[model samples]
Target: KRMLAFVAHKPMKIPGQFRKIFYEDFAVHRDLLDKIFWNLVEDSTVRSLNDQLDQVKAPTLIIWGRHDQLIDVSCVDVLENGIANAESVIFENVGHVPMIENPKATAERHLEFLAKN
Candidate 1:
């Protein structure tokens, strides 16, 4: 969880001022905000996911860290097999958000993956 979990843990296209207002002026407290934000996330997830297991129609790639604290590492396997055509790469030294923490390495790894695939 983020020290600032008030905002959903994702990048955005929403206006900066508006994002602040929704997250602060309207949100009375952190606990309430966390509940609301998580609820919204769940609602949005249900809207997108029609089934528990889905099959991809195209090639897919999954990059995961072995020591991810936010989620179980086994989730990568679940994702790999769930897709129609999928493969994965795991970084042993990483925790979470490898792209944010190591852009250069992530980019290099991505370039390598693209070149090979």
Candidate 2:
């Protein structure tokens, strides 16, 4: 259920065919998932990176979903403001995985960013 929510703009947007795939993926990766979760939970590097964000000199594009359940859209500002060369594009009515939920728009944004950068 959480996987579906993360991939889709909404739970109902999840295709019926992909439900079984997600279930199987979870079953196969449950142990790995637990390890990753615990590792990140214990890692202080995640928070410490904030102090270094301004050091990033490369152009950065932050494309986020307004409806992202896992990470709120408001956090985009942190990236945009912290990075030296950063911009953001917010996709409304979308969720965490914009590449999957709205591939066309994601690709378009990427193309635009590439052309500009």
| Cα-based TM-score, every candidate | 0.55, 0.79
| Clashing pairs in model 2, backbone N/Cα/C closer than 3 A | none
Cα lDDT of model 1 by residue, 1-117, tens digit: 242232223432557787778668655787887898899789967775324437466667777766676766798888877776677887766656667545677788888778777
| Count of backbone collisions within predicted model 1 | 0
Question: How well does candidate 2 score on lDDT at residue 106?
Answer: 98
Global fold similarity of model 1 (TM-score): 0.55
Residue 55 CA error for candidate 2 (Å)? 2.8
Worst 10 residues of 1 by lDDT: 3-12
What do the candidate models score in CA lDDT, each in turn? 0.67, 0.85
TM-score, cand. 2 vs. native? 0.79
Q: Cα deviation in Å at residue 34, candidate 2?
A: 2.4
